[model samples]
Target: MAITMTKGQTGLTGNAAIAVAMKQINPDVCAAYPITPSTTVIEDFSSYVADGKVTTELITVESEHSAMSACIGASAAGARVMTATSAQGLALMWEMLYIASGMRLPIILTNVNRALSAPINIHCDHSDSMGARDSGWIQIYSETVQEGYDNLIQAVRIAEDERVLLPAMVCLDGFITSHAIENIALLEDEDVKKFVGEYRAQNSLLDTDKPSTYGAMTLPDVYINFKHQQSQAIARAKEVVIEVGKEFGKKFGRTYALFDAYRLEDAEAAIVILNSAAGTTKVAVDELRKQGKLVGALRPRLFRPFPFKEIADALSHVKAIAVLDRADSMSGFGGPVFNEVRSALYDADKRPKVMSRIYGLGGRDYKVKDALGVFNELQKVLETGKVETLQKYITI
Candidate 1:
């Protein structure tokens, strides 16, 4: 069934946009438990279910773990499944996350990113999703309300693609994008249905003719073999993500890539960042450009597969690079994004002097001025040919 889009745009919060996208895709099942910031996503989608806007089976479960557990069960039964959560809720699903991916279930989860507890924070941060980076889920991060809407729809196709029959997490900063509204285009439901197409499960626990056992314990080497297969599938997912992104672009007006680059070509210095803060960094890039500074910014849209080579090549031309992370990895060296981005550039033909700056935990504001300060430091690194401080906190 081919789909179409509306001619105009409307303002929508990140949570609402995603809820609307879920309504359009109209999955067979949605197993959800409410949590802050992300609560609205499930709330709105449930309202759609109540109003008969979609044919989805809304399974309201007891806890976050049960929510993912139900999703795993529904997906194994060959139903297209989806869910939403944030912070502690995401942490609660940690155990089932591995189960879902290991079982090769393509469940799509929209994670409104929030800080993990201890002193307790209900605000935005990448820590929650970042902590699950190796949970074997395809992670696609959104930088805006519009991107949140687009990414969730694209994530469904990416996760369910045969080559990448892996669970996927579509992440957006909590409260920030989750509550903030922005003008975005809404696709005609029929058109989105056409784009996402129908769910085609290759293996089903419910297929009586060919019975199978799921979640069975594997022996020593057998477990490694399973992991090897999972590794290959995630590697294959990078290509699937690119292909689906192009196809989504072809049908819709917006195009997506592994990452979004802002004025990085021929740049002498750059900032590597993610999510909503990337927008701020881009403003800093523009301000620096007007002053005849050769600066740019790179924001990763896909963090799971890490896009190592592509990311490295994009920043290799720069003489100095500053990587920003919203959550500190607490590894003593740098933040998670900084570590990954720095590691990616190791084999570059001309590796730039890379440094890490951790900022904006607990929904702290990362204004353009903060970005400008980071760039100003990068400029010093460019001129001095030395990193005064390889890693440091920016707004602390």
Candidate 2:
């Protein structure tokens, strides 16, 4: 069956877009806890369940940890499961986050990006999502409300693929994008149903006739092999993300590769970013290019697999690249994107000299001018090989 697009449109927040997508997917079970920025998604889902729009088990747990635990059980029972959370809530679910993927459950989740607390701030940032970067799940960041809605649908297909049966997380900036209202063109129910069909469990523990043990604790000798298998599955998901994205575009007329390039074809410099900041960087890129400066922007749509090959190829012709990271590593030598970009181009015969600029931490505002400043600094780095490091928690 082929999915077809419709012209229906709605003014919706990123949170609401996610809820709408989840309702369309029609999961068998939804277990979630209420957390700021992400609360509206589950709230909308609960309303759907109450109004008879969706017939599913909606479990509202007292804490985020319990929410994920319940989802694991529901998924192990051969049911499609889903949930949403942010910041502290995500930190609470850390242990189960590992278990959900290790068990190979095709659970889909959304992490509305928010700042992690030392003093407790509740606004848009990447701290929450960055904290869970090492968890065994496919992670994709959306720069706009429409992308968030579309990615949630594609994430299921990527996670449930036979070759890559792991959980996936669709992340959006907490208040900046998640709460901001936008005109979003959503896929019709028929199109979504055709694109992401019924959930088929290949080796679920809940199968009665073919009973199998799950979450088994293994000895050291066998544990290495399990880790190796998990790594291979994640590595294979890179191709699945690209394929599913293409299929989604073919069905809905909206295309998003693992990394989207804006005017980067023959540009001399480019800014690499993820999430909502990409929107601002694009503006800077446009202005710079208009002034006879050959600048462009590279926005990473998928973060977990890192999209190293595409990133390297995209920046191969550029002279210098500036990686804007919203979160900091503290102990690491550079930001997450900076680390990945450097690693991706280190062995190339000809590659751009990259600089890491930390910005927009703790929900600080990042304007287009800030992006331009980074681009200017990148030009300076290319010309003279000298650039200053911006301290943490400062906007500019």
Candidate 3:
């Protein structure tokens, strides 16, 4: 891993950063449909293609499902492929998403996290991506514009790795990170090109010399086995993700981890979260620390391949823990992340009492006070040796 400093660092929105990353990686094909929050990624990248800025074969699909379908075809034909979508756009692609990963296509997707509709909102939430958590795609959440940019570049290498040839998504909070302007250090075009490297297909449909079948209907016996292999590949992706992130850091000077732990080492209580809200929680933690409170925060970057053991270890020392989720699982128990974290610590010898807090649905504002309130609840649980509510929603 060699670090390269580029002279082209500039201020960019997360969507612009995504487009810039795509231009540098220069995938063979990109297929997408227009959807809010994520639409800019497609719009910007399309302009690049229109201006002859990249050699990518851009396809403007009519719907998100078709966009993913086109990407799957291009990827199976041995082309590096990419796409972007949000909210119901992601919902429409649900069926094809399984096909992409089950066929082992290394397609990269930028999913701008947005609220699911019934009341119909075009705001930020984790509902879209969390619904696809079990879809067999590797998922990475971004906390800032810079992380959004860096993660997209790293996702290419991770998805295309021979040992982990599965589709991956780099997710950013919908209007928050995606549309917000922020300063970011960019890698020179040549550096990103060198970093991502040229993609080579191993079992491509185009390889007439060694022809193969894909997505073939299988009997129960064979279907289960194929699913087993997909499981193994995602399991292997955990290591590949770490290796790629480390290499990316060495080359680009921005280190990434499965999750970012803040002031957790000696803390007695902590809040676990993801995406932009983690930054607010950090501020709350800092304020609490000033008052000599042992408060900490954990923000998970990797959601799929859900680093269970590592998370359990990270929280093992705390007496009480609260997992804050932007989406509800509606399972009558807790949110998706809360369930996973609780399950992860079930077998630990000295497990902390964990509670779940759901907040910010449909782009509701979450401030430092909201985070501090969660911390205060955790402190109460610590003092009482019991959790009054296993799951609760944050108001305002």
Candidate 4:
């Protein structure tokens, strides 16, 4: 039977809720390395293991590289594996990250977004995950504690789907959402088990009868094809994401698409954002709409394989789009989301004029009024043929 709760149940922190969801999945092996904001998740899981509530081999690794390496080995041995990390720790595991995805290990990870170090800071930023964006992992950004828990549960299904055997990373803002307490309706263990089903590894290196080499060094001839195959798998995983999300909604009550639109049905302008910023933008969008402004917000839940078509389709009706990026692309053209939105609409017949805005760097608070300000700027761009390149911290 599904777990039932009263309407006014107490709340749980985002990291704690994520730990609850991870326990529901019942991973066979969990190798974790500690990092700020993300450390609490592993800490909670460790306590669960200590209480004998979970029967998984929990390894405490000294570094993130070893954490990912341990997951690869456990997964190769035909066990469902899990781990968590953030920022510089994510950077440290970069090489193994590619290997895990290339070997097609269904390792589910959570990245609490943190600013990568210069003088060493541990605040919310996308630099860490963005650095690994091309490492062949399915990336999903969460806007709320509930969504964070939900995405982590669905990630296993999407990654393990036979047609799309690739790893997935569920990202939530560090400190901002990870450490914030919020009421979240968690799924029952049986429901989660039914949702994820059993882990059946295909081409597992541990198969005794048909043993095969795992991660063997390949020459140019074979390496290229291997990468091509990985790309194809990621491409196919996009469909699996939609399917799993639909199934999750049917089992539970909440549902989210790759890109969710708020008041965009008939709007002249909209601001596209990801992660927790979407929640703030929704409030601003509603306020703007009430004042006779046709403004809306687009939140992309799935960031990898990017939901390009869905985003393009959703923004087709709007005259102009303001892409709000949490992390700036300092060396390149603009922020990650800005580049993605531009790429998605490049081929659209009725593409809307898009502008980029960088905000919330180093874990700065993004207020609802900030979103309203973005909408106002978008209105100006739509009415007149003028737009700013990059607007940072607009005083509203």
RMSD of each: 3.6, 3.9, 3.5, 3.1
In order, the Cα lDDT scores of the candidates are: 0.92, 0.88, 0.93, 0.88
In candidate 2, which residue ranges exceed 4 Å CA deviation?
1-7, 388-396
lDDT of 3 by residue, 1-396 (tens): 754444655778899999999999889999999999898998999999999999999998788989999999999999999999999999999999999999999999999999999889999999999999999999999999999999999999999999999999999999999999887888888999999999989878888899988778899779999999999999999998899989988987888889999999999999999999999999999999999999999999999999999989998888899999999999878889999998999988998999999999999998999999998888898899999998889955
Instruction: Give the clashing pairs for model 3.
Output: none
Tens digits of per-residue lDDT, candidate 4, 3-27, equal: 5555845477889988998899889
Candidate 1 wrong stretches, greater than 4 Å: 1-7
Report the Cα lDDT for residue 102, model 4: 94
Candidate 2 structure, TM-score to reference: 0.95
> Which regions of candidate 4 fall more than 4 Å away from where they truly are?
1-10, 390-396
Give lDDT tens digits, candidate 1, residues 278-330: 98888888888999999999999999888998898888889999999988888
TM-score of each: 0.97, 0.95, 0.97, 0.96
Point out where model 3 deviates above 4 Å.
Answer: 1-8
lDDT for model 1 comes to: 0.92
